[model samples]
Target chain A: MIQIENLQKEFTIHHLNKTLHAVRDISFTVEKGSFLGIVGKSGSGKSTILKSIYGTYIPKSGAIYYDSETLGKINLVTASPREILHLRKYEIGYVSQFLSVMPRTTALELVEQALLETGVSYEKAHEEAIDTLKHFDLDESLWNNYPNYFSGGEKLRLNIARAVVKKPRLLLLDEPTASLDNASKLKVRESIEKLKHQGTTLIGIFHDLEFMDGLCDEVFTMRKAVVNAYEA
Target chain B: MHVEQPILQIKNLSKQYGAGCSNCLQPNARLEKNFCPVCKTVFACKDVSIDLYRGEILGIVGESGSGKSTLMKSLYFDEEVTSGEGYLEDFHNGSLNIFTQSGQQKRYIRNALLGMVYQNPMLGLKMSFSSISNIAEKQIAAGSRHVGNMVNRSNELLNQVNIPLKRSKEPPKNFSGGMQQRVQIAKALSSNPPILLLDEVTTGLDLSVQASVLDLIKTIQRELQISMIVVSHDLAVIRMLADRTIVMLNGQIIEQGLTDQILEDPQHAYTQQLVYSLL
Candidate 1:
């Protein structure tokens, strides 16, 4: 569970001395296991909000509270870098819009590394990675291929599989299906649906309203630095 | 006087994306698959047909993406319908399909015939507009040009919803969540539309606040006799307000009946979980 209160985030262009307000006093709560979708047009700060939740972009004001089962409630905004790192490694997972290309690493190794870092055995990690790639409908031939060699959609699905390999408690996605075609999108939706049914809390920014409508339990719309939310 | 016909009639409505090909060309064949095997089309809504009588509350209960909101948005002209017909008794002689109407005609129908209360008050209320002016905007949209009449009607509606006259001049940004919702309700009722569509109106509110808003809604429904379609995931909200209920799962209505009968004897597995969870 997470509670974001009066969250404000801004980016400063030092050269121009101009401050870009990204999130302005937005407050909302995401219940555990529920999917919260953030929808907005381009430049509406939807991704900024996701980044803030992911703890990569600290808010200029207000607090983000995470109700962890083991650690109790912690303020993410004020959380130490180590604490944030630990949360990311164990509790929170993020899938960015672009895949961070690992030139020499295969897709299987990339996903297996996520599990290995979480203390899973190397053999177990490999097996799980295979299953995850299959769930994403990634072809068997693509598992040993480098992300750079994969198509845009293949890379995105690999990114998703890697992020969700550990089955983190909360998963943050920025345009999860942005690069996929209709069939691939459908495949990814099935994977997301399976994850949801398994009780993984999801927060994503989807410009595709119809996709978001079908996937999200609640949706927040960002406009002019303010946010308004509604049930899906 | 004779009983009036239903204000809204939806017939075999289906909203799907992509054109089906050979393998999935049969009607509703796409719905059985995760995605259409032929075209990869997703079914956002499927053959949803329902009617809203003149003065009755029709509740649509479902999990997210069950097509409940899509169904409402289609009626409000917010989402375009892919197929099937809908007719509003008071618009275009009751024979013209509301879904097929031109954008201008749809806008006219939305302004004069329908009122919507969103789950979040911020979506419905202009936070910077004075509470009175928020109500006035709807009246003005319905072609009320006289400021005096608009203000009078705004005040009357606000009073009916129990929003104080003193706060009517102030913007809604400073109001509490419940007050903001009440203001949204007042604004929605400003034009005295024949039909009101509510999407999870009490969700995310504190229990006491939810009760008060529900009470206000009940009073308004009884006093104004406006036809309604209320969509919610919460069964209790539906039980408290709706006369009839439709249970939806994955873009299809799994069950429909009187609220009491459906709750008492839920036949569908999903409806059973929903009803039992409420208890």
Candidate 2:
């Protein structure tokens, strides 16, 4: 339900007086309900492509065509800021590699905020957030604890749980399991697999080939800002 | 998706502290840190526009002298706009520009449709007035005449913000910093305004007290569904509370987006530094 065509992005470093090409040229499409995994080294533009689709980065020249369930078919690159914001709220969900924990916010509150911001009732959001955290194997005792004090794996799990709790139509994960132990990784995988089974489109960047092998329908390898996709 | 009009819309709002000269009158006048170097005009807020949706908390974040507080003050009518338009869905069906309203009309709107909690408790609450009287003062200004009804409502509001009944009769001057802020919140909510403007409500409180006040604000938002505009220099408070965030620099909005997006991947260089500094 998403199409990327000739996506090119660059960063102009003013002090250095040079433009760094983050994504030189990349194009791919992900069908509805299918999982796409992007594998690449540092600065290979894997995250850049994801950020473009999420409307965080404006491509130098390209179109990110997304078939939003709410806003019809729209090019994310050209969509109005309000429309992009609306889509981000209701249709697209992104889980970044690092958890940007808000100080004074509890783990449960962080997850519930995802639902709360989208107009979900407080009681229901609270219940669903707790259930999602439990599904991600975060201990019950940590529910009220601040995520800033949590272990890396716990924080990652909490981050994933917060994003997936709302069940957006499109879910973008950036190194979701990077800090997790094997058991925690399995739990996160199971939760993601469940989301995919429920028809949420998944696009994830993973360093673990084995973890991605069992999940993604196709793998796109990026090298030096170029992408090559093949069936898993 | 069906489009929803913003509960409050501000367009091209500008507030300046001095008379403009030829050098600063130009549309593209370059200012030295939000002040005109030649004319000595301080542009506290320049061409600021904002949209606050129903039941959402919109955050304005910037460092001191960035004019975030000025923007909040202008919206709450504590400061007059130099030029701009403000529309509230509850005011004249969103057809009237509130900035141009008559003094009486402006007072009516402020009393009925808007609530503001200042950063300093002294600015928002009377020092010698009992907490309940402070809240009742707002309800009375909003046209509540029955003393008994006003008292009950004030008690309920005080309790809602976690003020104990025993302390309700005490003046806010006797309260702790956090408690004074809570009382200020109760006073602001007394009018049952559709929109609430809060300026650094938890800025000076202890860490533990800050958390509780923040928690109280979140709970109040969920329960009351009041659209709020929160102004603070603290990005952490904005991240915890704001649904959408606007980043201000030198009296102008440099960047704005979903709070998650702003914190995750800020686009502007200034915003990048602000977000990175948080790490």
What is the per-candidate TM-score for chain B?
0.93, 0.98
Off by over 4 Å in 2: A15-18, A101-105, A116-127, A228-232, B28-31, B263-269
For each candidate, the DockQ is 0.01, 0.33
- Model 1: residues >4 Å from true position, as ranges? A1-232, B1-4, B19-25, B28-40
Global lDDT scores for all candidate models: 0.82, 0.88
Candidate 1 docking DockQ:
0.01
Candidate 2 per-residue C-alpha lDDT over A1-232 given as tens digits, one digit per residue, 9 for 90 to 100: 9999999998765445568898977888999999999998988999989888887777889888999887889999888667877887798999987888656788999899889878888899989998898898899999999888889889888888888898989999988888889999899888788988999999999999899877999898898888855555
State the lDDT at B9 in candidate 2. 95
In Å, residue B84's CA in model 2 sits off its true spot by 1.7
Give TM-score values for chain A, per-prediction: 0.96, 0.97
Cα RMSD of all models vs. native, in order, equals 25.8, 2.5
| Worst-scoring 10-residue span by lDDT in model 2 chain B | B258-267
